[model samples]
Target: MGVSDTNYQIVYRGHHLEYFHPGGWVFFQRPKEAGGGFWLGRTYDFVFMIELPRPVSLREGILYLQQLKYESAS
Candidate 1:
């Protein structure tokens, strides 16, 4: 699937975290200080959801969410 740049930009970023809300889905990433690296994940209902591999960086999370946005469109 092809994703438009304007459509998938992250909606928010702060405190070492990033957020993207594309349609009903909510995607976010946060640092895992204890174990190191970061946590990247997404949800539709905000309760049940999916996660990218752990031990990732904040940049990786953003890309993952962007990809999710594109894939979800399909």
Candidate 2:
């Protein structure tokens, strides 16, 4: 499958988060000091982050993964 330039926005805690145009299998990297680490107290440190290709639903994510697999097989 080809890539899609779909985007999604998320708002939380009075903050607006924006993500750039994305395709399948999006990932967000959070800082270790900001709670993305393996520590216990800072578990909720990832306050703001966004993923690409925006999963409209669980089924959509599944389909996207399947498409990725198909593309890799080719």
Candidate 3:
């Protein structure tokens, strides 16, 4: 199933934490934090689901998201 088959929502604004679900999987981006401008949250859902090995950086998260799409393609 290509990523197109997988239901999801995407957020890019750097505002307060936002929540949105476009399909079976929920997606969210953690708001920026007070820790020296680094986002204390995430660009992808990590709080309520997706047991990540460790918190991923913005770039890493984006890359992983891309991979998710490709994987589904295969």
Q: By TM-score, is 1 or 3 better?
A: 3
For each of the candidates, the C-alpha root-mean-square deviation to the true structure, in angstroms, is 6.7, 12.7, 7.2
Candidate 3: stretches off by over 4 Å: 1-18, 22-47
Query: Model 2, 44-66: lDDT tens per residue?
Result: 23432332333234345445556
Clash pairs of candidate 1? none
Candidate 1 structure quality by residue, lDDT tens digits, 1-74: 21245433322234422443534333333334455554444433345244654546656766766787789999
Residue pairs clashing, model 3: 1-72
User: Ranking under lDDT, best-scoring first?
Assistant: 1, 3, 2
lDDT (Cα, 0-100) at 13 in candidate 1: 34
Give a tens-digit lDDT track for model 3, residues 1-74: 11245344434345433454422332334445622212222233344455355545555655666787799999
Error of 3 at 9 (Å): 6.5
Instruction: Assess every candidate by TM-score.
Output: 0.40, 0.30, 0.43
Q: Candidates 2 and 3: which is better by TM-score?
A: 3
* lDDT: the better of candidates 1 and 2: 1
lDDT for each candidate structure: 0.46, 0.34, 0.44
Best by TM-score: 3
